[model samples]
Structure formats: C-alpha cells, structure tokens
Target: MTHTLVQDEAAIRALFTSLVEGMRERSPARVVARYADDAVTFTLAPPLLNAGLDARDPEAVAGWMAGFDGPITIEHRDLSVAVSGDLAFVHGLRRLAAVPVGYPEGFSMWTRITVGLARRDGQWLITHEHQSVPFYMDGSFLAATDLEP
Candidate 1:
C-alpha cells in the first residue's frame, strides 16, 4: 500500500468512528449528516431500501433513532477498507447493543456492514450503506446473528 492508500484508510476509519459517535449521541440528525445528499441505505428496517436522505422526511430517520434509548454501543471487527481516488468502501462485522429506555431490554446482535463513500469537495460522505444478517436456508428461516467473527 502507498502513502495515499494509508491516508485514505485513515480517513474512512475516521468516518466510521464519527458514525459510531453519532449513534452513541442518539441524534438522528447527527448521524444523517454523515451521509451524502444522495445517500442510499439498506438497513434492518422495513421498506427494504431507502434513497436520498434529503428526499425523506427528517422525522423518518428520527423515528428510527427514537426506537433505541440509553447509550448505543457498537463494535466493528474484521474491517477492511479500500480506496481509489474519490471512491472508497469499507466492510466489516458490527455488533450493536442497546436497551430501550421505556421498554424491556432489547437483544444484541451482530450484522454485516458495508458502506460506500465518496469524497465530495474534500470531505468523505457515505454514499451507500448496507447492513444484513444471514439466515438459515433450512425449512425454518432464522437469523445467524449468533455467529462471531
């Protein structure tokens, strides 16, 4: 790897760090700010896919954030980042744990995460993101979140 690659990797890592911080803060706006205007996300939510943060109501994102209460802790492992000029991508396994403030405790699970970023005007912004949990192919469909990296 060259010096530029090292720098790119550092920058991308910083971006993910910021994302984790934002989640810990429990501020949807803060987290959404890290995404590009045209950002697309495939998360653990319904509707399957979301496109353009600006196109959706801010409350939509806030509602999702509001589902979680207390401090949100996330751990990323097996991280791999690649960069080529203004384009970059990072993929890893993420474990998230949080409890709902007013409700019963929630379950903690690990999911696969991949985020695509673009350097726009010297700043790295997430352009696309996907989070998934593999499922068993047997007769019963079950998430394989119990697996560890």
Candidate 2:
C-alpha cells in the first residue's frame, strides 16, 4: 500500500473512533466536530434528511440520547474504507446498545452507516453521513429494528 493510502486509512479510522467516543460521552458537539462546516447527514430518525451545518446540532443528539438511561455503547463491524486523492468513504454496520431510562433494562439497535470525507488543506473532514436500517417492503413500511448484524 502507498504511504498516502495508509495515512488516509489511519485518519478515517481515527475519525470513526472519535465519533464512537463522542456518542458514548453524549456530546453532540464533539461528534459533529468531525464534520465539515457545511456537512449533510441522513440520520436514522424521522425526517431522516438533515442538511447544512445545523443538521449536526447538539440538540438532535441530545434528543436521541435522552431515551437511554445508562451509558450507551457504539460499535462498528465489517468496516471498509477507501480513499482516492482528497476524497474518501467508509461503510460499515453499527451497533448501538443502551438501557432506556423508562423502558426495558436492555435495548439495542443495529444499523448501516456510510460516511464521505473530503480533504481540505491538510485535514480530513466528513462531508456527508448516511445512517439507516432496512425496512419491510411488503405493504408495511416497518423498520427492521429487531434484526442484528
């Protein structure tokens, strides 16, 4: 592998790890810091499409974290990252587990995530993020939340 490829891979890996850590800390600001100022996202929540920097507002993250009583843990598996020049993308399965404050002691979710990054100057910043779960296509548009990766 080329030196640039290795460095790019490491940079993307660090960004991914930082996202997990930020989520665990329940700090949306920290998580959003990995993105570019004009970043866009397709989140798993309702109104899935989020555009512009406001899309990464800490409030959105806070709303999601509010459901969990205990600390939440996030893990990504089967990750694959590719970089070419100043652009890169990463895709993987993400697992999020937590105990809702008012719900069952154990609750978990599995979803797919893809991130697009752009190298500006000497830094790599996420420009796009898409996260989603499959849904039933037979009449009912029910999300497959019970499934595991």
Candidate 3:
C-alpha cells in the first residue's frame, strides 16, 4: 500500500508537470490530455463552469491560449495531494504569468485550485477542477489578484 501510494503521488505530480509544459508549448491538446473525457471545470473564465467537451475542443482551447502574447507560464505552489483507493484530490496555489496579445505590460496572478481525479484504466485523470481568487469582503468585493502565496 505504501508503495502504491508513492507511485500514485508521483504520477499525479507528473500530470501537473505535463500541464505546465502544454501551456508553455501552446498546445491545447497536450493540456487537455491530462483530463478525463467527462471532466468539468470551474475555471477563471466566465459562465461559472465550463464543460469538458468545450475544453476538449482543440480549436476553442487553442484560440484562448493564443490570446497570450507568447508562452504561458504557470507554477504550482504548496500543493497537497491525498489518495484513497482510486480517488484523489489536490489543493494548491497556482500562479499564472502571461502577456496577453493586447496587454504588453503582461500580468501574473495567484489562484486557489482544487482538483479531483479518478483512476481509470490504471491511469489517473482529472475529473473535476475548480479555481478561484478570493474576493475582498469590503464593499468593493474585488478579487485579490495582487496577493501572493
């Protein structure tokens, strides 16, 4: 059991690495490959939640990724993973640094993330992903994008 847990953790870690590489390489297909066929996401984007099918669409995904002026860089920090049987969950802070096509100044923000994964065919795949940036309690209610981990 100990050995299996270690292996599982390593595999999960590799998935995050793949995600970073995919984003950096501007390959939507590569990034979506980490997810299951039925994956769902509550992304930083609008509409509250995004369908897995939408994410799987290479053209659409690529279009959004292309908004970046160049390669997109992301770093995962203070990540925590827990595994039990074929289910796992991870929570962490992700820093997304990018230069949008129209924004020469570029930008970077830290978002809280929670991901749920399931083992299918002996491979772990992300089934659900949620991301958010805390909002101020004050009347402004603006997202605290300026904060860091």
Candidate 4:
C-alpha cells in the first residue's frame, strides 16, 4: 500500500511513538504527559469506565510499572491512523512484553487498542484510549491472552 501520512497524521504517529517510549521507560509523568487533562481511558484492568485520566494516574501507573521486573516494551501492529480536522483516532494492536517481579518467565500478550486524539492549541493530545483482549466463547469465558498478530 502506498501510505504517506499527512502532516497531522505524522504528528499523531510521532506522539504515539513517544508514548510508547515513555511506557518502556516506566515513567509515569512521561506516560501520562501525552494525554489531555480530561482524557478517558479504558485499560486492560478493572472498572468498566474510566471518566478521565484516572487510568493514567501517575501513582497507579507507577505502581503497575513496579510490578514488572524491568523495562516494559510495547509493539504496535496493524496500526491505522486517521485524521480529520482536529479530531483523529488510531486503531491498532499492541503487544506488551515484560517479566513480572515474582515470575522469572516473561510474558507477551497482544491487545486490541483504540486511541482518540484531538488537536488543542496547535498540539495533539490523547482524548481517549481503550485496550482490551478477546474472550473465549467456550463454556469458560476467559480472556484470550495468548493470541498473536
């Protein structure tokens, strides 16, 4: 496919790249910095709905990062970024790879991701983000975490 991102789309892509960098670094401040003050997020964790940056709370994010043994790497796949005016959204898959503090064996999981962004004051900020994994349709409705892209 002949894909050439426009200026806005390029900027948004860069923003996502930086966000991933922050996540790998496990820096709460940097991780949350790309989001707007009232950005809503539905993470892989509990709570059906997160009203604002609650999902990206500095303390909560830091605690979660602490659960990992070392750096947390995120790889985005099948990414689709669309931009129109000041509103934009990205649909993609994110693979999180990390080793837990107590578990010597590392883990890697791919989750569906959707990120909504809006341009404010000539800057692009994440206004919403949702991440989830599919669930088995069998008798046991457990999350399908072992799937690969």
Which numbered prediction scores highest in TM-score against the true structure?
A: 3
On residues 29-125, what C-alpha lDDT tens digit does candidate 2 reach at each position?
8888888878888887768678775667778788888978878899999889999998998999999888888886786889999989998877889
Q: Model 2, which residues run further than 4 Å from truth? A: 1-3
* Model 1 TM-score, all chains together: 0.88
Total clashing pairs for each candidate: 0, 0, 0, 0
RMSD of each: 2.7, 2.3, 1.6, 3.6
In angstroms, the error of model 1 at 67 is: 1.5
Q: What is the TM-score of each candidate against the true structure?
A: 0.88, 0.89, 0.95, 0.92
Cα-lDDT of candidate 1: 0.82
lDDT for each of the candidates?
0.82, 0.86, 0.89, 0.87
Using TM-score as the yardstick, the better of models 3 and 4 is 3
The per-residue C-alpha lDDT of model 3 at residue 97 equals 92
Task: State how far residue 136 of model 4 sits from its true place (Å).
Answer: 0.8
lDDT for 139 in candidate 3 is 95
Q: Which regions of candidate 4 fall more than 4 Å away from where they truly are?
A: 1-5
Instruction: Name the TM-score of candidate 3.
Output: 0.95
Off by over 4 Å in 1: 1-3, 54-58, 101-103
- 1-149 per-residue lDDT for model 3 (tens digits): 33488899999999999999998988888888988989889888876877768746678778888888976999999999999989999999999999989885889999999999999988899999999999999999999999996
